[model samples]
Target: MPRSVLVTGGTSGIGRAVAERFTADGAGVVITGRREHLVESVAKELGAVGVVCDAADPRAVEALAARFDTLDVLVNAAGGLGAAQPGPEAAELEAVLAHWRADLDGNLLSAVLTTTALKPVLAPGGTALAVGTIGSERRGGSYGAAKAALAAWYAMLSAELGPRGVTANVIAPGYIAGTGFFQGAMTDVREQALIAETHTKRAGTPRDIAETVFFLASAGARHITGQTIHVDGGAFTTR
Candidate 1:
């Protein structure tokens, strides 16, 4: 029998790849994304169920939970860089605050809100993995701070859920190349500098994180919880 898994933000990059990986492994995968068309398209392509929901909205999250009765895995792959606020009446300080707020909501609260909504339906001894960034420990913009919050929240959740046989962990990635994650933000020097930091001298890929997630969710990782595993090609450990 295939285990039922839910992956949020499953239309792109890390989330899309994670969804595919689970499907390949014979899991009954359901994915969610904000874009209804893209979500539907990806679902059709991958043979997974896709729901349209914004993770930041409580109602939407609650609705998301209503879709599942029991979940074997919940991968919170819904995070990204926060940007400056958009407003004409906002002042300078408020604009700055907006940037942080955006990041926090995008990178941190998505997981929190989604997980909280799904708590009742999570299968016992289930596995959960959230995508984090090395930025939490280094120069990750305001987005990093949000990811840091995510890690801490997972620790709290793990403490509460551990006895129930549910495991939650974070996978912090570094320098993932070829994803819209960079979105052409990198100058040549910046890209090279990142590559230099990794002992492997190679950028990480979505598949790298996906494979690690597979392991962490497997029986072999049953003993592990409340942990952060770096998937950054030794960039974080060495640099």
Candidate 2:
């Protein structure tokens, strides 16, 4: 039987690419997106199952879990920068709290809730992959902070899942060009500077990350757990 894989936020960008890679590998892939129509369209186009779900929502995640009885891989790619929330200038404490909460909900909580809800369904020897960002390693604000927290949380998760034969890790990318990640925030000079920082002198592609995800889910990566694999072309290096 083909390995069953679940990719949340698989309708576009990196998530979509990861789903496609697994599908090509003959995995029984299921993709999820918050939007119904897009989920349906992408699923049909990719010849995989699609479910509409907000992975951050506990109830929705529970409902989503009911759709799959067993999963060999779970990719938590259902996170992105949401709308601009109240800035530091905002006076109301409630507004400030809500703003930060939204960031966590979108980026960190979504992965946590989804993983928690589906933890039981994850088969022995399965893998869990969470999408992260280089922003967390640098001057990450709210969104970055959330991604950083995600990486930290994964360490603990790995400790628990490792003995059970399930592996957990985070994939952080830097300045990927093909995705809508920049969201019109990137200018010509800024884009160039980002590219120049990389040893490869080019923005990373979704396929780059997709291939990494595919590798992590393979038997070769069984010894590699609780680690963050940066596919940023040497943009950020560790000594």
Candidate 3:
């Protein structure tokens, strides 16, 4: 049988690209998203299973885990910047707190809850990967901080799962385009600025991150774990 793979937030963006790559490789793929219609549509497009799930909800994560018998790979790709907050009249401190909580729940707790619930059924020799962002290292604010915490958490997760022949890692991408991540706020000048920051002199693509994700889950990467791999085209070079 082909390897079974689950990718959360797989309706679009990097998650969808990852699912497509695996599907092309003939793996049995299951994808989850918060929107039912998009999940259904993407599932049909990719010929993979579709699940509607809110990964941040503990109960929902548990329910999702119960649907799987065993998983060969788990990709936690279900996170993004929280929705924009309301205007000034929305209670200053309350609005700020809610915004932070939403970001933390979406970007951090979602991965934590889903991974923990599925830990028992992760096949030996499998891999668990989370999608992180370059913002984690700098001026990302709450969204970046959530990803930073995710990287920290995954390091410990690798140690715990290593003996079971499982590996865990984070893939941090910088300025990937065509993901609608900017919510239509991207300007020509801003895009050029982002591109200039990269040694490649171009923005990254979903395929760029997808390819990295595929490699990390492959046999060649079995020895790598508890690490954050940057796929930013020298934008965030590590010394």
Candidate 4:
């Protein structure tokens, strides 16, 4: 039987690409997005089930778990940078705290809650892939910190889930272009700098991440659990 897969941020970019890849591989996929329209559109287009869910919300995550009959793979790709909270002009501490909290909710807790909810349904010998960022080591601020926390938690989670035959891994991506990741924040200098830092010297694409995820979820990679695979054209490693 084809495996049942879920990509939490399946409406766009890496999540969309990964969902497509799994669908093409003959798996049944369910993609979730906060937006019903986008989720429906992508689900219809890819021939996968679409569920509207907010991973940060415990109720939603539980509902998502209840919706699944059997889960073979769970890809937590719904994380992103939220608006930075305002801070005191004198301290700049509030903004930092707020941003970090949002990041925790968006990047860390979203996956944590969702995974906890779905842990029961996740089949033995399944894979759970969470999307992480290279910024945790780079110039990452609150965003990076939250992702760093996620990586840390996944280690323990992997140990706990291992005996159940469920593998939890992270895919740390570097400089993926056209993902709305830098939709409003991209600057000419930052763009040039990113390009110059890579060994491939080309921006990473969503498909690159999709392929890596595919490989990690494969039967051959069953032993590769609790690891973070970087798919950034050597940007995070060498740069």
Ranking by TM-score: 3, 1, 2, 4
The regions of model 4 sitting more than 4 angstroms off are 84-92
Name the best candidate (by lDDT). 3
- Model 2 lDDT, residue 111, Cα: 96
**Of the candidates numbered 1 and 3, which has the greater lDDT value?**
3
State how far residue 139 of model 4 sits from its true place (Å). Answer: 0.9
- Model 3, 1-239: lDDT tens digits are 89999999999999999999999999999999999999999999999999999999888888899999999999999999898576778888888888889889999999999999999999998999999999998889999999999999999999999999999999999999999788899999999989999999999999999999999999999999999999998889998
Clashes of 2: 0
Task: Give the per-residue lDDT digits (tens) of candidate 4, residues 1-239.
Answer: 99999999999999999999999999999999999998898899999999999999988988889988779999999988876657457357766677778888989999999888888888997988899999888798878888988888888889989999989999999999889887588998998899888899999999999999999899899999888788888887742
Q: lDDT tens digits, residues 1-239, model 2?
A: 99999999999999999999999999999999989999999999998999999887888899999888898999999888765467676779867677788889999999999999888988988999999999999977888999999999999999999998999999999988878776878899999999999999998999999999999999999989999889899999986
C-alpha lDDT of candidate 2 relative to the true structure: 0.92
lDDT of 3 at 32: 97
lDDT of 1 by residue, 1-239 (tens): 79999999889988988999999999999999998899999999999999999998999999999888899999999878775656999888888898988888887888999999898888887987899999999987788888998999999999988999999999999988767777678888999999999999988888998899989989999999999999998888832
Runs of candidate 3 with Cα error greater than 4 angstroms are 84-88
lDDT of 3 at 143: 98
